[model samples]
Target: MTRKRQGQQGWGPEHPEQHYLVQPRTVAGGGDVRHVSEYLRASGWRDRSKRGGPLLVESPDRTLRVAYDPHGQPGGWTIHGKATGSTQEWSAHLGRQTPVEIVAGITDTLPLPRSAHAPNVWGPLADGGWHARFEGNSYSATSPDGTAWLQYRQEANGTALWWTGATDTRGNSWTGAFTPTTPLHVVQAFSAQLASPEPVMRPRGRVPHSSKIRTWSVSVTPSQLGAWQQARINAARAATWARNSRRTDRPSTSAPPYANAGSVRTRR
Candidate 1:
């Protein structure tokens, strides 16, 4: 008897045709084979692959939905929003002007959480909304996902100053007075100083071995910060028309402007 070769298929070798079977599936589309309960269990492949394309998919519930600019990416989940609370209290440091240090965990002591961000020293327009001074850094409460509300931090000298926004119940003054139209799921905020450093600070004698201890002089007045706060309030208001504009857009067309000398606060 002659030995059969590995690649050759003949009567003597295991019949290959017998191994192949013809079966039909109920589902017409060519997708992964999964139970109705497990809709996309075996379903593989992304629909469109482009910068902004749509995605083709079947939900776990077996519902089919068309997504724009298909990326064949995984389905996104929903996130719940959270409120910063109804109270508004803040502390102001008079040294220069900067974001008040939100004493960690003691946020409740102020008005909202000490965790809230301070407003920008730069003035807002007659109206208010998000302000993206630089490329895309915005001073607005509300995340890309629309699940969070962010605020700005005010700084003076080289440190944080009074934390504004979130107002008191009596419409007096408190820590956090601002409330989000939608609850904040993610808390996002930041602080910064004048790029030139001339507006907010003054040059002190250079240190023997370190950078000069720059001082902050308010470019805008407390009344200005207050006005900016009001603008913010109007912007946050749901019925306000100013909310239509972007927040980063400053009222003054002047380029790279800073706040006037106000007050300063130091880090504790």
Candidate 2:
């Protein structure tokens, strides 16, 4: 019996079935599948491929799948399994951002988790302050000049709690994590710093008595103050109108006789 000699039977220029088999095309920026697969698995992705078809890895929950195809068009890899069927492609040489990082970045852009205890006033408060609650976190800010604001947030990670704060005046910010306790004193210190008035700087040397004293003052006539007050009132009215309109569009839920009234009276 004569044994048929084995020969190259796959695609590519040297293969006998080059015309019938799909040509291996270069994925722009995708250098090598081996390298991509190595990096992905090194970054905590689990390889689920049993027979080595395409490079397939999934998140812990299997909600996300990152697949690498050497012959895939546009790019080499596809990020799919999102509810919207939204997909992102990546090539080896093009994107320095990893697939996992990209998914995390997208997740961060989503709206904060809504809470039933969320503040009714979504915008700035009447006393030049603002506060909101979302996903068990509290956010607060005080804007004395509208443009310059002091903001703070208390965030938690499992059993750990921390505080982050920022001031719009000088764009100063701070984050304190891994504290043994709640670190309420740090928040108090930040609040005090925000409340402190800007220091008045003067020349060390005494000026000549002949020089006139320069002073600054903000003057608002009664009419101007009244107009400002009216503008705030109008804004509040508009916000209330929009909120009521949204509620009207939704199905009404059964409530006790004083449920709505009680909610209105409660302070967040």
Indicate the TM-score of model 2.
Answer: 0.21
lDDT of 1 at 198: 22
Mark the 10 consecutive residues where model 1 has the least summed lDDT.
18-27
Runs of candidate 2 exceeding 4 Å displacement: 1-29, 72-75, 84-268
lDDT of 2 at 7: 30
Cα RMSD to the true fold for all candidates: 28.4, 30.8
Reference-based lDDT, each prediction: 0.23, 0.30
lDDT of 1 by residue, 1-268 (tens): 3445534443353321111010110001112111111212222212332444333333222222222221223221111123325623222111111112211111111112222445432323112232333223324432122211224543344332222232212221112222232122112221111111122212122111112122332334334444544543332232222324433321221322223323443311
Question: On residues 120-179, what C-alpha lDDT tens digit does candidate 2 reach at each position?
Answer: 222323332433344445444443433223333354664433332222222122222223
Candidate 2 Cα RMSD after full superposition onto the native fold (Å): 30.8
Evaluate model 1: give its TM-score. Answer: 0.18
